[model samples]
Target: MSQETEPEPSPGPKQENGPTTTGSFLCLHTSPPLHIALHGMSALTHTRLSRTAFDLCLELLEAGVKPQALADIVVHILEFKEQFN
Candidate 1:
């Protein structure tokens, strides 16, 4: 059986003059499991949970899991919760 691979995120245009303004910034793609996890947590009314989720994604990346896998994990979690709860 062949394992599916996630597509690489496109690197948007580089800014010649350095960082662009925050409002104009685009997050075209993110690592999967972690990204999905963070996005789900972001819906909560609690600020701490949201921040923690973001931090978790960063830590996962540091640990060397592919971003797409992290996103997929997040998606899996959310789906599991929906089915069970």
Candidate 2:
């Protein structure tokens, strides 16, 4: 059964030195829902994939999700996908 999660706090401005609040996100440890979304996004054409990734990140930022971590995950996934071609 799926358990409900607590809502994440909205992202704040970056802190100087030490970890920022969002730093705790750690993309590799992302939840299953996000992993599914990223996997679906990876199926698009090259240009579309890039644009879709960017748009998803922008939406995540607006939703107060971990944009930087999502961006990193997108980049890493894209890089891994590209290497096999």
Candidate 3:
């Protein structure tokens, strides 16, 4: 019997400047990014979460996770919340 395996997802088309396109900059900054919102919590919590979120953002960007993709995921989560709540 042959085993079937799922293919790894592609990161869309190649941009001239890699994944850090102008659109990505806008998506990550023009609107308050998730890490920025972490400031609303208590000072201690904010410091920890913000630092962690910032590190995760750097890791994601390094891993080729586009800012627009992150934005899309946030939208999907919001939609899910709206539908359920």
Task: Name the top TM-score candidate.
Answer: 1
Over 4 Å off, model 3: 1-59
Model 3 earns a TM-score of 0.31
Name model 2 segments beyond 4 Å from true.
1-49
Better of 1 and 3 by TM-score: 1
lDDT of 2 by residue, 1-85 (tens): 9999999999999656432234434242234466566556655544346545655664566457775687678779878997998
lDDT at 48, model 2: 40
Each model's total of backbone clashes: 12, 0, 0
Instruction: Give candidate 1 regions above 4 Å deviation.
Output: 1-49
Question: What's the ranking of the predictions by TM-score, best on top?
Answer: 1, 2, 3
Instruction: Determine which window of 10 residues in candidate 2 has minimal summed lDDT.
Output: 19-28
Q: Provide TM-scores for the models.
A: 0.39, 0.36, 0.31
lDDT of 3 by residue, 31-72 (tens): 354435533442445333345555565457645688789757
Q: Give the TM-score of candidate 2.
A: 0.36
Model 3, 68: alpha-carbon shift in Å? 0.7
